[model samples]
Target chain A: MTPVLIVENLIKTYPAFRLGPVSFKVEAGSIMGFIGRNGAGKTTTLKSILNIAHPDSGSIRYFGQELPGNERAIKQRVGFAGGAVDYYPRKKIADMIAVTRSFYDNWDDEAYRKYMDIFSIDPQKSPRELSEGMKVKLNLVIALSHKAELLILDEPTSGLDPISREELLEIFTALKERGVAILFSTHITSDLDKCADHITYIKKGEIVASDTMESFITGHSIRGEGRNLEEIMLHYEKEDYREKFAE
Target chain B: MKNLLNKELRLSSHLLSYLFLFFSIMALIPGYPILVSAFFVCFGLFQTFQNGRETNDILYSALLPIDKKDVVKARYIFVCLIQIIAFILMAVLTALRMTFFANATPYANNAMMNSNPVFLAWTLLIFALFNTLFVGLFYKTAYKFGKPFIAFIVASMLTICVAEVSHHLPGLEFLNTSDRLPLQFMLMFFALVIFVFATIISCRIAQRNFDLLDL
Candidate 1:
């Protein structure tokens, strides 16, 4: 089966930092947990895939088409949710949704209404009135309602309570069952431990590891027992730091 | 593109309404067409810069399934709409003053109206120049606002000063007289041509710059 997303040799530069030369792929019907520490280029990489941040060099293929060249078409099938809803703060939730809905030809009103009911989001509330978790939920509702086959989220669970996080994990599982691919960046290792089928770990702008989550855990296991995602991440990060300083 | 334009207008609707009200009040103050024009130009510049500073709007727009060029086009269209509204208001006010208050103290000696078509054409050219400089510089940088804002103000003031100086020169004195209607009409035509070119060039520069912008 064709992968839902393919990124190869993606590189982006800023005055203070540089992102790889990184490569990864997310197969259809899988949850790919993009795990990284703060400023580890996760957001940069995600943005590059969408051409929100133009890459210095790389090729990104979404649903088998080159990005930017196929940006409008690719984006139509890919839904993105940042850490928070950065929509017009003064506009009502209904108004914001209406504006977003107009841009997508595949927008589903029933799906939007379903998520709104599940999330308990009031259509009349302004963005400022919603809590951070609610804001993330709002973004999710918008993304999921558009019939996107691929969902890319940045720090999606960072501000959520444990129960809300669990609910979102359930939603991701349901999406995967429906053959939708997901690639979400997060520092929350436990969320990945519970739900991620694949893990791609990035450290300071480089991919330290990318493999099946079970393989990743067993490879870094202590004795015969597999380590949790957090312990594995800490081990790799420390190793990278020691090697850098030793150089 | 239509959806993007609609979003831009919705985002700036409140500010646009405030500007309309302010211009309406200013229009009643008889002898300051130049001041009114300058304020209209500056307000347009200010609104664009202020909107650019709203990073949330930029980020949100980036997520939409549209090309960066479409985003630039939507913004340019928004600026044009605001200008059209301001100019129509000013024209209506001028007509009112010319009709109902022609003999009133402030309206009786209005020198600006002696060459009405020329003054109106000059106003359009000033707006076009202002849009060109402001939009071109803003899109080139995309994020910085202070320098572009200051540069536009300086350029506009210089243009006004040069026009005022020329109006007082003996060789150009006929420009303000009724006997030189044909000359005024020619100047108006020339200004309109420059206005169209400046607007086209500004949009082209904006589209190019925006396509390369990272966010």
Candidate 2:
């Protein structure tokens, strides 16, 4: 199977943060877990992939074509969801869907409709009235409906509850089975445990770990007697475990 | 281009902007300071541009299958659409008012259609030239600063200032209206040429700036 995404030595530097000449590839139909601490450059890396942030150097290729600076052409086969899914409070879901579908030549109207049904999204309802969960669900519905070969989600489960999260994961599995590759970016390791095939760990603007999920989780573990998950993640994350692995 | 225009219209909220356009145009009856409303009506097209740039607005549009150049081109077209509409409304009012003072002999609406096709032609030529320069420069500037209000203010100030001067300043009191027509024509002709040249240059600058846009 061909790789759906191939990023080579990408770099983005700013006064406060920096990102790579990082390189990696995601095979079609595999779900790659993109994990990092809160400020670990996960979003920056994803933004680079989307062509939302221009890279300082290196290359990115999607479906074997070099990504141009133009978002219109590079983005059609890709469906993206992030904190970036901010919709106008008054915008009706139907209008957004129709407008969005008009832009993507490969969009699947049937799939989108199915997700709209599954998510219980009322097309007539204004997005402002929806709960955070409902909004996230709607964003997913939009992304899933597009028949995207490559899905790049930045913290897709941010505000989702367990039930909603599980349901979303189930849908992700279904899509993976249909040959869609997914880059699931999240800090929640629990989510990765369920859905990830490969994991890439980013730290301080560089990709510190890029390996299969089976190998990544094997490299570390969280053990605690009722400690907060965030605390444990911070504990190991602060120690630079990847350096130990290198040793 | 049509697809882009149609989609942009929808993005600006169908029926809403059109309503705004309707009311704005209605305010352009030239006799009673109504022509002043043309500026606010021009705001309709600019607002549409603004709506597209709101928080994640670019993210969604960036996902479309069209070219970015076409996307920018669509914005230029929308500006034209609004400008044409605003002019039509103002022209009609100007014609209607002119009729109030004219003879019983029937005459086609001169102000709206330009009784002298030369003036209409020249007016259209100059206005288009002015507008194209304004849009090309201001659109890219908007992208750079992402501040529509400032860009709007600057473009509005420049266009109104220039247009006002051209409208009132080209004729001298020392010369007869008939004799000075040639001199006025020359002034208008030079203005038209400069405006066209400026617009072309502005569009070129816009193209290059977008290539290096931080986003």
Strongest candidate by lDDT? 1
Over 4 Å off, model 2: A69-74, A221-236, A239-247, B13-17, B20-35, B103-148, B151-201
TM-score of chain A of each: 0.91, 0.86
Model 1: residues with Cα > 4 Å off, grouped in runs: A222-226, A239-247, B12-14, B21-28, B41-45, B96-105, B108-115, B177-179
Candidate 2 CAPRI-style tier? acceptable
Candidate 2 lDDT over A1-247, as tens digits, reads 5588988899998899888868888889989988888888888888788765778998888888888754555577787777436666577778777776766677788888888887788999988878766777777777667667888888988777788788778878888998889999999878877888987877777887688875555554433411333443565566777899999
Task: Give residue A161's error in model 2 in angstroms.
Answer: 2.8
What digit string (tens of lDDT, one per residue) describes model 1 on residues B29-48?
65454544644645654664
Q: Rate the local accuracy (lDDT) of all candidates.
A: 0.77, 0.64
Chain B, candidate 1: TM? 0.82
Clash pairs (backbone) in predicted model 2: A9-A21, A10-A20, A11-A20
- What is the CAPRI rating of model 1's predicted complex? medium
C-alpha RMSD for every candidate: 3.1, 6.1
TM-score of each: 0.90, 0.79
